[model samples]
Target: MQKTNKIRVGTAAVLAVVLGVSSLIGFSSSANAAPVTINFWSRGAQADFIASVGAEFNKINPNIQVKVTTIPDAEFVQKLSTASQSGSAPDITSVDLILVPYFAKNGVFEDLTSYTNGLSFKSKLSPAHMALGLYNKKQYALPFTAEASVLFWNKDLFKKAGLDPNKGPKTFAEIEAAAKAITALGGDYKGFYFSGACGGCNIFTFAPLMWASGGDILTAAGQPTFTDKNVAKALSFYNRLWSKGYVAKSAKTDNGASFAAPFAAGKTGMVGAGAFFVGSLKANPEINYGVTPLPGATGGKGSFAGGDNIAILKGTKNPVEAKIFLDWALNAGQKFIATKAILPIRSDIAASDYVPQDPRYKVMADAMAYGKTPYSVAYTPLIADGQSPWVKMLQSAIFDGKIAAAQAAAQKQALAIVKKQG
Candidate 1:
């Protein structure tokens, strides 16, 4: 993650003053104090887990109650936007990492720097995940969970291709060679799979390839850097795989959500995706799979660290109560690691025995050391505009056979978007 020293200490100082005053007032009126209720909205998949955590928290702090509402992932952002405008937003909400900057920039969240600084476990949070919560040097959100993209290879397919099933590809050349070997087997199986048209999917799985090659789409200053030679090198590498018929045809139109279907169905030898793919693969039970960190252009590894972040909305009536819930929810790392089979945002818990003992999950856990989030300013507009120039660039290069022109056009458009955000 890119670090900027542009700290807004003033925001923390202001929040501290408000919190101090509220504490004194609450101390004086303890006998007459009423129960506090805070509304929390989160994505559907984590609803049950979050509600369970809330139940645990309420047992300890009987004066505070949490009301959790689950929203469909597809409609979360749109609904949050509507609620924010109408002053009906929940007191607290969990948002995708990519949407954090857009909300922070639009003044929809409250700065939590002071609260975070006060926590005993603050330093135990993953820096890469915490970096996602930052906007204009202020911590407006907190890392709720963490995931890393990795390459999932079918060991059975590898064995059939005459390659060692235990050894996963570690370089772009190795990946290509392995794909070629698998494709040479005449069957309905494709060598590789990915969502070619899905912006978020490609960014999560492919941007790390660019990073591992020592290239980035944007600088810390939020300037476009996609025209770099290494960027082109990585993009061209994908073009080669697509052009050679190694990638599945369904990839051309697969949205990120369903791209893993081919791999799960045992129709593809390898798929690049996040830890969630483990669930799908496990359900099949027939495809013997192993996970590895995404291979670099040379031999290094890089991954995109992604997950939802929790934040307090700007107009919450009970900021203090909301903070209590936020801290409690995030601190329940053991529950998430044990129950969800997902990594915790807290480094201490992630490194503890609470994490799964399975070796496959270790691939993702180890990759977190070198994982990164995109520079937020560049990412926000790219997502908001619904125009992923990188995906288009790949489409042009592989499908339209216009590599050079596509690279030039993408760089120009990406630069314009970043400059406009400035």
Candidate 2:
């Protein structure tokens, strides 16, 4: 119920950083310099990948040097904010899709739409992913990855539950029923498990349930739509699952452990996760699992679109060079497809090698076409706050024995926040 403090970056320092980059870019090295040292920054988690991309790019454009550095993942945004205010920001940076809205809103990015005009690559990206890096109809960034929520069930668990391992749940009702059966097996494992603390995953996995059932937290115009009966019905489904003890208690405090730990340990019957999950599964062949689509409402399927975005800083003096690099990233051939990402927001490459061919990966790519992404400005914090109420409400209603009060209280609070956002 307490308001979470806003951890926004101070504006002054960031503004200064932007100016510094601009001045540096203006300095003349040689017209065809061998290394045009450009500062590149990435958060801890993505630093390695960015470094690899830099290495590959350097091989082709040896004259253009990209110096990539890692910012602590937890503090990456704040650091960027600080750099921008301080007027010492990097020439280029990769941002989480969720943060794009905030950066775009602040006018901290170079508008690449005009530079990219005449390019029809935008049509190649899925609508869900295409929306992540867009703000006010301008393209500030290009997508670096595409991910969505997918159902992952332990084939062994399904067999034990008298369900077909090859045929996973297609509808929410079926998933609920299967979960109940898995719980009846009764042991260290549960029928299903997911993060109660994870806002992004909650939206990806659960919001679809709300939307598929004909409800949504916010409408296309960004109005609160949670008070609608459909929304309440979706919430009720979650409540019923928790109340029935199909969810593990550990899920309450767990944001990461729920899916990875349980699935890796072979304790959970089912989970909804991204395609990257396959990499983790590969590490542990001992754990047998199968990937399936996220369950639909009655029969319809949908999932949230997710990915990273790249943008040039607002004050960059080398918009031409930066735009060249952006274009190269989305250009045809191996460079575009080599990153294991979806499309480069370019259709030509979207259907090319970038689209995975494996059965599991194909499912992910196919789902992208139908996915929908939430537009949450300052998304990292908004998601945390938004999902917390629903999680707490479900906990009390299902586990703590206060169904009616919990429902009324949660609905009352969530609706208020939604209204405020509207």
Candidate 3:
């Protein structure tokens, strides 16, 4: 056997690997062990799916049972933080990828470098998500579910507007043309819709468009690039649509309360949304739709990788059992995840690997090939906040037509905030 260097980290002793024992521990069945129950916490929306996975795990490892708890998502962070500080955290946590940096930096999560390295599919994890969980160059969490932003064109409406029902727009001009045609339908018909005042929604949709043209909201140094030409062009494209009255007026002040309502109601021809939208539209089967990756001004496509990453919190009684769950989640458990129309964390898994009720599920999963997540410790403050400079910039440019001024002001504010927060 080859000798390897090993090191222990923090309270969990997240060991380094010589020849990873963690892998063997994770892969072997846990039925031989004494009955042990581990606590697992998941955000409210994911609780049902999580509980099912837990039940499945128990079916195979009868002795190592997992108890799943639902944590209201709005209070999840604060509660988790407090519990982590008191060393009363759960054995396993399904953490939002964006929150990984904060927890990883504070050492709230156990270092899983050895176990992660041992996984055969480790290289298949999203690079952006993996990087988010890094602290001092060590891995902490693995992506759990994957969400990607996709453009949705109403197929019935497209056919009504004389556009090809079978084809969706692929560039800025095409989107504009399609929107204009749809709006010309008169009475209760609008070309496009967006939640103008929702920062999170924009990141899921608009940010991908910003990135499609080889531009980014954050520079390599983790600073703002709101003033990038590509960004301005993308914003301007929307501004023109708004100015031409191609976008629904409700979109101007929607504030996310009725974000996707117009589209779901069949009152709008197109919208940008994620996997949840596909699921949400199940009740609106009357509205036929097609999904495509958000497109750039000239060409290319992009999407924001939004979802949770699973990790073992620092003081768990059963790291081995936790490893078993995490391993299964990234490996065997992926079958269930993909079945739900979500992309698997492992790149080797594709949407076509299984049949989907909605063929667009294939489009959503296929988008992962070009999906990305931004890097910044101040993501919530500078981007997710509805009143943040980033969001306000979009409102200013699209609603107020202050394109140049908005970009400059937002760029400055974002930089100062990022610098101070860092």
Candidate 4:
């Protein structure tokens, strides 16, 4: 059996507030009225945060109670699949952004376009996140959180390499130069690290490099275009770095789950990461680090806009109540940003003073302006089957010394997968 936790209201003050607000709104007056409970599921790591939000929501809407179940990341999709088949799915779920298209296509989620159309906050959501929720012009999901992949460097390591600790690489050439400088110091330290074995990580960090160079992994029709010149150029750049011994040896075996450990441990000089990395690095006070937008291949910056989307499942018996909860949570705006430390999904929040004034956060906020997601249709099938072909291609290029062969094979496999999905 899967582990589960249920949040219940026990505080008198909280109950008083719930009753007071309901009475003021003329929603309910009887203290003995039983609340209608709705089931919600989210990633296990965010169980506490979601539980808090659920508690607060219960305070305002006394008629509806939300029971949140936290599921492990690796098992979430499979568990949801099992539940869907058995007619036991939760009313609401928080889904990984990239998987939204696949779920929507399979009719696992309800089309929320009509419900969201009348809401003012609907227009405020980030376009990049909106792209993930749209399928055939229908909206099936709403943005829950936002994040972008960026470059992070250790200031202490930079200083030892005789490089300015205050400045970060803005172009591929600069990154290459910095990597060489740091590697020259020798020992167990490596200049850079990334998960070569993780396909999701490759899409998060490496695809942006290709995008910044005017290349894309998939065409508009959702077909594989990895053989495109721009992508090949980015691959060649990585091949060069791998051949020069600048990347950590562990990169070959590390998956997305543990890729950042070496960077946090102070063994790696630079890493490509997202906002969550900030908290992880802060936990290690000894490693002084700085962040910047990911450098472009030739020049400029790029980032993979990523996060989760919230949706009501098609089998939900409380669609109206679910919509109400979603609208309230999203309209909380700055409160959500402060609590989550994530990029604001709302256009109004992104532009307002609600964001932190710190420089590190500023870099991430600015990167959001140019950040992009891969074409959703293509990306859906590529990642849905299991380990992505693109990831296999990367491993092949780095470990097997077969860049050309890997690129060719990946293109073939990607095209087949996309076509079959269609």
Q: Largest TM-score belongs to which candidate?
A: 4
lDDT of 3 by residue, 226-245 (tens): 88888988899889889999
Give the Cα error of residue 8 in candidate 4, in Å. Answer: 39
lDDT, residue 39, model 3: 88
**What is the C-alpha local distance difference test score of each model?**
0.78, 0.67, 0.82, 0.78
Report the error of model 2 at residue 79, Å: 2.8
Looking at candidate 2, the ten consecutive residues that score lowest on lDDT are 1-10
**Per-residue lDDT of candidate 1, residues 133-183 (tens digit):** 898889989988777899999999999999999999999998888888888
Best by lDDT: 3
Q: Per-prediction TM-score, please?
A: 0.85, 0.81, 0.85, 0.87
Misplaced by over 4 Å in model 4 are 1-30, 44-48, 351-354, 377-381, 384-387
Among all windows of ten consecutive residues in candidate 4, which has the lowest summed lDDT?
1-10
lDDT value for model 1: 0.78
Residue 329 displacement (Å), model 1: 1.6
Q: Residue 209 CA error for candidate 2 (Å)? A: 2.0
Error of 2 at 215 (Å): 1.5
lDDT of 2 by residue, 1-422 (tens): 12222223445556666666566656645433235677777666454356777677777876666778888755776888888888899887777776787788777887877764666655665566457667899887767656666788888888888888888788878889888988888887688887766665677677776667777666665444444666666666666777789988777666544545677778788888876666568778877787777755686776666656778898876666666566666563234444544333444454556555555666676667777776756344445553555555545644565655765676566556655543
